[model samples]
Target: MPTTRNFRTRRRRLSWPLIAGIIMLHLAALYGLARALAPDFTAVVEREVVSAFTVTITAPPDPPPPPDNQPEPDEGAAGDPGRDAVPQPVTGQPPKVRVKRDDPLPRASSTGTANQSGAATAGDGTGAAGSGLGTGSGNTGSGRGGVAVTKPVHISGSIDNARDFPVPPGGRAARRGTQVIVRVIVTPDGRARDCRVYRPSPDPEADRITCQLVESRLGFRPATDANGNPVAAPFYWRQEWF
Candidate 1:
């Protein structure tokens, strides 16, 4: 029992540090409670603890990929996969175009029917075939298969007889053997317009006389072809003085 008492004394002496730590812990707890009761010390302590341990962890950056050694695209090449191939023309087909030939005019059959014979033998005399104004039939009316006969144009005009028109030094008299060509457009109303001397006479007086006659007294019923249709046409007249 004496040995056990000495061992307990030594054990108590060794436990003095633990007892001091416990006392310090109790004193700190008491001080915290007092501060908390006095003010908002628990909120301040929580804010300080949060600030002390605040951390931001960032992820590392990724490395760049290796470059491929692909060839550059050809600018002129057809690169699209969906595009259709170029079309090739088919062989053995003739090109589309008109073929020209120099064929002669077809001749009428001499041994045709009686109607063709009659047509060939229709136009006889009266300057019909020579004038090229015949309609085969001898009818002279303004209808089908007939000839259109226009009325004769009547023209009269006075000439300046006093004017000698100045003869050239070595040439003949300007008034002698003078001729004028007059062009007149005959309208459907039997009236003329656009009348002028297409060919001038040697004498100025003859040209002036021809122009006055054409402007004043030129008249015509509209000309007609074999079809008997009235058509506006241009007519010419040559006036001559001996």
Candidate 2:
């Protein structure tokens, strides 16, 4: 047995419009991809931001007015007589004066008597005992009631007259003619009782020997009062030694 075969065939053709539409779609997609991948050319503009605030300012208050009760100065009172007057200076008390005093003269005679009762007491013409100024029997007032000293103490003889003075070993090296001053106290008998150096020499040995030489060997004339009586007194002795 033979079977019959049936074959159906349909043929479709692409039209020009369909092909153009597909090509235009592909071209549009390619253009969109290019546009997304490529860099954009846009203009860049800088914008500055500014901030504003509101502020309130107030001025200081006005000064207060003067008081109504205050009195004004008088311009006419500037020429007042008391304001132009000169003031007198005050005087102080004067200083006191000092009086001079005269002392009474001393007398050796017992007949003289000084009356101290009044400042004007007058003495006898012979100057025995009145407070008045007159010639007296004594030499002069000792400044005290005793007789005044007439002669002062002095060296009797040359200092070379003393016993041989031995110089120390180093005496030659000292300054030549160095002077030493010593104070010697003499008794009424014209003998030196005490001695001390008043002024020192440049050499120490000279000063040490001065007192010993003055007290041991030096002699002095005793000081005499106005009545020629001997009295103890001090004498200054100056000597040169190497």
Candidate 3:
């Protein structure tokens, strides 16, 4: 019975120590919870103290125009405003020209009239002497320089491929003849000067070939005077095919 009483005293002492340990554990848990839920004073003060600002922009007003009394610059005046202030005068005068008159002829008198009458009478053989004097014997009713004028002589010829006067291409068919009237200017030296084809063929090819042939091959003997001398006379030639 004494042992049982001692065991109950020891249980009471152990129960008091356990109660103190439980109380210390509960106080530590409450301190951690309070620290976790509390606000950060330094971060709150920094965020609250910062500030932001907004700005607005505006355009400037235009300046006033310049005065009108100032003279505007001239592009062609080389920066000098008074350069065109001078006035110019014009002079008038007539152009000079030289003039001269022909000399007057001598006046006719009775003596001069009589002399001219005698000269005319002698020339016509109506003077006292019935023979005409001071005249050329060769002065007949012929042309100038005593050369007898003859009529224009006409000559005719032909341009053909068969005869080959101009020698056509070999083995080619002979083209039909083209008649061309050629007028030739006969010079004083008996040579042809200006030879022209006055009339051409109806066919272009025939006209070209005929004109070329006539201009190359045709010639003539000049006409003769009464003295049997070749004279400067006109002539003509005709080219045709039968």
Candidate 4:
């Protein structure tokens, strides 16, 4: 009878590893099915998982610099309106002029003619009338203590048959005429001092006679200095004898 009871006396135990394996296999199959149904499902799940652990922060940009500020110039208070059109009176002191002791003093001309210094001015009418520069009925270079010499010395030589020269006979002067020039040094008193033949004639006798005639007949008005005083001057006298 015991042999006839060949029934199973051993009971099978529960396998926990097989059950965990089966559950993992089912999860993998479900993931595949989700990828097939919606392709972006895995990506969305991974983004949500990362966002839960990560923190993000943003900052604002800086502001620009301030602008420059400057004051404008005033136009109403610039300058005077009539400054350049009208001449203004000088307010400063005049400059000093230095003159040496040896330098001559400047004097105004009394003659009616212009001199080296300045123009002529009218004088007191006393002498002969003058012509040219200013209106003055007076002689020039005749004033005492004048500024400059307005006129030079003059020579007067005239031939007179009765008082002057006598023609030489039987000479070259009588045939072709003889020309003679003499240098006469005049005194301050208007008299001849030294008379010498400057240009001689072909005839020596004519030269001698001409010089003698110059010393006697030639008259001169003496030259005046800057002070209007008479001064000695040289005169060249020329004459022709027939």
Q: Write one digit per residue (lDDT tens) for candidate 2, span 1-242.
A: 89999999999999999999999999889767766675252111111212233356788899899878978788766654566677899898888787877765554434436634333434443354534323342333222233427544555545553234455466554546678888876666778766778898776666767677677776667777766766656778888743
Candidate 3 lDDT, 4-63, residue by residue in tens = 443433443558779899999998787666656764754564466663333456778888
Off by over 4 Å in 1: 1-173, 225-227
What Cα-based lDDT does every candidate model obtain? Answer: 0.60, 0.62, 0.51, 0.64
Q: Model 4: per-residue lDDT, tens digit, 1-242?
A: 35555577888876999889999999999889888898798879868999999978777778777877888779767565664586778899788887766633347645544334433354344432443222222334333323325333556865444234444576434635557788886655677767898998766776677677767776778767665666556778777654
TM-score to native of every candidate shown: 0.30, 0.38, 0.29, 0.34
What's the C-alpha lDDT at position 64 in model 3? Answer: 85
lDDT tens digits by residue: candidate 1, 42-101: 678778999999998999889889898999988899866887888898788788798786
What lDDT does candidate 4 reach at residue 110? Answer: 58
Identify the leading candidate in terms of TM-score.
2
Overall local distance difference test of candidate 1: 0.60
Q: What is the lDDT of candidate 4?
A: 0.64
| Ranking of models by lDDT | 4, 2, 1, 3
lDDT of model 1 at position 231: 47
